[model samples]
Target: MSHDFDLNSPENIADPYPSYARLRTEAPIYHSADPDLWIISRYDDVRAVLRDPDRFSSDVGGLESDPFNPGLEMPRWLTGLLSRISAVRVLLTSDPPDHTILRRKVSRAFTPRRMAAWEPRIREVTTRLVDDMLAADHPADLVHDLAAPLPTTVIAELLGVPTERNDDFKRWSDNLINGLLTGGPRIPMVRSAIAISWFFLRTIRRRRRDPGEDLISLLITGEGDEALSQWELITFCILLLAAGLETTTNLIANAMLAIFDRPVLRQQLCANPELAAAVVAETLRFDNPAQGLMRVTRTEVTLSDITIPAGAYVIPLIGSANRDPDRWADPDEFLLHRPNLGEHLAFGSGIHYCIGNALARIEATAALEEIARRLPDMAPAGTPTRITSPVLRGLRSQPITFTRTKIPAR
Candidate 1:
């Protein structure tokens, strides 16, 4: 079959399933000439690429252009600034030894214990946000009111970001992620990256002088060469803001949309709060927040009857893989009770698998439980807006409405 897939097209961005289905069947290892990237769409094929990191390396340093093709032409100075920012390699882009070291240092602070400890606080924050929405008016936007802020607030606290600078962190995160998803003018993205790097560097310096019980302080106080460098610390903070904030934000929003779209499913979840966890898992498979991720081939490799030359870009379409017919019975349907949800590549697989998966799940479960219990009757008040980025699948704004429950007198 002819390969005519356009990854950046609006039709694919709004609804990529049909395209993904066609690609998976016709050209599972199709190469797109426009982007000059190889696309892998089958579930097993995607899993194979993700697990075999040695062949499909994450270290895309020598690539001629940004794998996602942000489409920005920057002044040389801004380009240099972005280069300096990129130099502080985080786990997402690093492979093997470097990834291992960086992961260890960050893991010291981002422990399972710490994440478990945040559960109550996550619930408290969610309840408060729902309370605020309940008090304000009907037709509240779940994205802004709850989904966006909950993870940002929780992550800000974990990272020890000062309450006053929360807005800056969110703004910087949005700018960086937007630049990544849909490359626009280079200046704004470059400026935001520079500003955020400076902000994090300043915070790191403060943590050095006066260490506290936060992730940044932990990284600052860690010992040995394995410990994160000042620049690495700053970059990790930026990574955390993006990973922790954006992904979880979308998970909640996507889960809500899935539940609301199915009245019976919504009622079932509202009736049995335990089902909320299942709903989250199904959403991760049905409409994963991250649509795909890029990896560069270290050497010539053949996958699914096609030989991709060395240094070529290969993208594992996570969204498509999740719905692969061979893996999932009703690949496109949202099945809350679907078994073996652990099989989904939503958080990816292999060494580069998302480290914050646990935290994201906890935050999402808590948010969904709160919404199901409190806003059970909530329905879309207006057309939900989608984030028009090829790599990110999420709502830009999801306005919803329900009968406002009266706040009991304090």
Candidate 2:
């Protein structure tokens, strides 16, 4: 079986699912090019590793054995420079008890009550964004008009950043995240680290002076040692910005593409607003924002009769898992009526499940529903440009031409 995976290749980055399917069937655990990291494409194997973090460590040293470690790709001096900031603020990169503490501390801020209370605000924001897009002209690129700003605005609101400065925050957040996803030298990464640290420290100082009703302010006064450490504060802020920005950004873009791919489904969705959630879930499964994640083994483990040595890098193909034959029925097809849609690992599983899953769902649902309702005539304006990054999958720009709808007067 062919094992070469040119992650940089435009073809692979744009639609690697077909390749992933081939690998999952022919080589469940195989090494790929560029550091020859071992990837687990089968749902069972990937799930096992994700669930057992003890055996498959999430630590950096563990990453040394992985094929795609930046440190391995960088010069010694550059690697040393990048090592200054190794702390992971969010739950995704941590493991076990520590992960539990940090997650619990922030989980309070994501309660059902909190989400429900924000529904009206979400709807208002969605409506305002749709109105703005209409003003821009019908068939606007969803990425720039709706998907990008919606989450950034929400994240800024959460962090207590003044709405006036939200634009700057969004720019900085995009730079920081793009740096991480696109493999490269450590300079951009270092700069991102500095920007994040500065942003959080400044925010913390302000919150101390005059606390507000926001996540950052609550974080400033939250009880217990689990209160985000200074380092965690910076990483968390960056995490919030990046996760909030990219995940939903790709989701909305990918959802739009999926709808456009199948005009029948698009028509069905445009006709019914309530089916948005189901459509969103199917979209997630169909073309997830995140493509894959890396894991390092702490000890030798057996997956699918293959013995992976301790410290080997494991790539969990999320795209493959969503379409795993052992899991979903008619794995290749998109079925809105599919039962147990929530079981899909689009947000992942175990301790590292996405912290922003609910928020992402809300954003996708709101954006898609509003678009379907307000701009039923919307269609792809031109060839969409997919972003180049193995970790993220979505259009960098999706130009669309559509018949503009007039907003009703207040």
Candidate that scores best on lDDT: 1
Q: Mark the 10 consecutive residues where model 1 has the least summed lDDT.
A: 74-83
Residue-by-residue lDDT tens digits, candidate 2, 1-410: 67565554667786788877888888889876567577788887777878898998665432333233343344222223333556544455667776788888888887867866777788889899888877873457778888888888888787888877776677677666655554444576567567666877998988879988888877767667747776666666766765668888899988888888888888898789778888898989878988787777889988889888887777888888888888889888888978867777788778788878888889889888887888777888788877777667887788877676584422
What do the candidate models score in CA lDDT, each in turn? 0.81, 0.75
Give per-residue CA lDDT, model 1, range 140-248, as digits (tens): 8989899988988888888888989988877776777666455545566677888988888888888888989887887777567656888777767777776667789
Give me the overall lDDT of model 1.
0.81
> TM-score for all predictions?
0.92, 0.91
